[model samples]
Target: MKSLIENPKDVKELRENGILFSRLGSDEEVVELFKEIDTYGLGSRYVFPDVKMRIEEHCNSKAKTWMAELIHTYFRSPWTAVALFAATFLLCLTFLQTFYTIRPAN
Candidate 1:
């Protein structure tokens, strides 16, 4: 499919092709559409589409598992992932120490 950004003037055509504005639309056009809507004096607002935000939101909303979502959030920052691994290792080490101790017996 052609990119909506590549066809800013063909907003209606995109809609006809089953591309909703929510799924695809130019930011400037969206702003203009909101302006037009405001010109009609309707109490509404429009949020410009952001590709990165849309991707993250989709991942968060459609994730089948909480772990998947958590991993996605953690990996968004490299430091968070590193910290997660370190904390997990520390916790496991503590558990191992408590459970598997070498005892000196008579």
Candidate 2:
């Protein structure tokens, strides 16, 4: 947590999300607190090792990374997602119609 916070804004975001609460005067105080905690050099034991491993695995997966990137790049907007769905539906309908036209009637 100490390593994750680089500035007061990071502390403010954590506070806003209820991940952190400080009785200190400002977000800067929280940042300073983290820095102070970092100097203590906590031991090697991690609180959530399993969760950290799972997150690392997810971040390392190539297919999932590519799919996430694709969605982030092309489907950032709702309208783009809707258009892709509409286009896929039209394509499937076109393929079905073509197949029916080519086959003999029962």
- Report the number of the highest-lDDT candidate: 2
Which lDDT value does model 1 have at 85?
90
Instruction: Kindly report which residue stretches of model 2 are placed more than 4 angstroms away from their true locations once superposed.
Output: 1-32, 35-44
Candidate 1 overall lDDT versus native? 0.54
Q: How accurate is candidate 2 locally (lDDT)?
A: 0.79
For candidate 1, give the lDDT of residue 83. Answer: 93
lDDT for position 106 in model 2: 100
Clashing pairs in 1: none
Q: Which candidate wins on TM-score? A: 2
lDDT of 2 by residue, 1-106 (tens): 7655769986876787578889999998888787777445565446456765675687689999899889989999999989999999999999999999999579
TM-score for each predicted model, relative to the true structure: 0.35, 0.58
TM-score for candidate 1, please give it. 0.35
